[model samples]
Target: MSAADTTTPTKVPLPRQAPPPTAPITPPGRRTSGGATVPWALLAPCLLILALVLGYPLVRLVTLSFQEFGQSQLWGFKPAESVGFDNFAEVLGDGEFWAVVVRTVVFAAACVLFTMVVGMLVALLLQRVSGWVKTLINIALVASWGMPIIVATTVFKWLFDSDYGIFNALLSKLPGVDMIGHNWFASGPEGLAVITLLVVWGAVPFVVITLSAGLTQVPKELEEAARLDGAGAWGVFRYVTLPILKPIVVMLTTLSVIWDMGVFPQVFVMRNGHPEAEFQLLTTYSYDKAFVVNDYAQGSAIALLTVVLLLGVIGVYMRQMLKIGEVE
Candidate 1:
């Protein structure tokens, strides 16, 4: 065989190497399916638990709220007599109920605002201090937070009690002879004030801890640069620290509102929402309806209403937080 005849034929392109056996082109949907199934599988148990615990109860509560309960209906198993919104109408028509709602809103607002302010102040003070002072403050705040709610309520009740209260004792020594042992719980506004003070005192510690952690995250370099640029301490805080702290502040405020709206222990212990239900907030009202009045249906409705109000507030806050240029 001559060289030319024996040589393998000159190499051909071979149809462009068949495009290098390109990887099996997965459909977009199929790719999504592959990555998504694992997460869905893992989340199934959580979803199931949530449905069983939260979703079912919520549905049941709504259903029960529409039903009528009587003394004979001890188990509440009898088919719910269609009340046709009578329960809601009756609740809305009641002047006392509306007053309680308004009072709750005002109380919650006051508590949240005062708690945030006091928390921020305490946090800033701690930031500037060192050594034993900071440690002591932190310990006191944590101790208050760690105390059982029932214990705290009992202590506050005793402290504020009119008969043998330390408060009344001190006031009596202040030369107020006319009403030395005046019944604090008998007065509506006074009872409400006591509740507000207790709520504020209990919640401030949480706000302080959250804000202090947020304050520490403020960049030292930014603060220093601001100072170098002739910014005062207040200016540095306003321009640098506050903008970063906005989210935390908003979050803390929202949480405070939620906590105060559902306030129960203080009012329950202080006077059991007494003096014509003077210190009754939404949670106390619900408790009275459910347990005291033996009207779980009405109580569930009130509870649901509270939940809705909270959700509405949260939604508004989120909208404000998410809006561009709103934080600054």
Candidate 2:
């Protein structure tokens, strides 16, 4: 009893400590509620404006998709009644529709990729240039970025026109480009190539400006440190510069996707809405159905499909942004 009691009597009380401070948690892509709450008064104006400007048109378009608004409805006094999912069935059931959808996705992707690459290169070039050359570049960039879409398309047409195009003129002088006219719009591929070049040319300026700005935000010391560590120029950029520029690059690339989706004027004017052109992108198809073919309800359905496709693309981008925001 004496030995057992002696061992049991040595119970020292443990010291209590305050619980470790809980870390502040924030949902991804959302601001933490740690600061003063935003007043509804400050947000209401924006919300109302958005509702009228964007919300109403979107709802109207969606509603239009379900109605059979044909030629008779468009010009006639007869009101079009809701036709349920008939418009959707017609658009989705068609083989040509799916073909156009696939083509649209590929075309948009190509344009975005090329535009990003060219823009990045131009941006890098701008960083290395200075003095009057840099000033001229900046001026040229602003002009290109600000140019009218129609005007740009027109200029591109002149540059690529088979008979009188400067491109053909240059190519004919080369070793074996005997195809005199080399019709840019002779086939779908040729037409798309011209449009792609036009889009890239116009889009590069914005990309250059944006990437150049982003490059400025990168810490110079980090770059210097990397270089001091014997990293080559490409290595420094790959490891250090690119990591900092990633967010900007992703954003600009997504914007390019959106801009490339509805490439109407370029394709329309180039093809002159030729039915024989073996390719059909969603934008042109929708316009053809709605206006050219005079099938408004079916056209609206296709238009809605385009919107849905865009939303899918945007959702992917938002997820990436949210992940980045959460990590910080």
Candidate 1: tens digits of C-alpha lDDT, residues 1-328: 6888888777766564454666778876566557778999999999999999999999988876787864446564675576757777777788877888999999999898889889989998999997799999999999998888888878888888777788877777766454457787777788788778888888888899989999989999999999999999899989998889988888888888888898887787777544257677888888788888888778877887888999998997788689725545
lDDT of each: 0.82, 0.85
Best by TM-score: 2
**Candidate 1 vs. true structure, TM-score:** 0.81
Residue 89 alpha-carbon offset, candidate 2, angstroms:
1.8
Query: Residue-wise lDDT of candidate 2 within 107-152, one digit each (tens)?
Result: 8888999999888888888888877898899999999989988889
Off by over 4 Å in 2: 1-49, 273-279
Clashing pairs in model 2? none
**Model 2 reaches what TM-score against the true structure?**
0.84
TM-score of each: 0.81, 0.84
Clashes of each: 0, 0
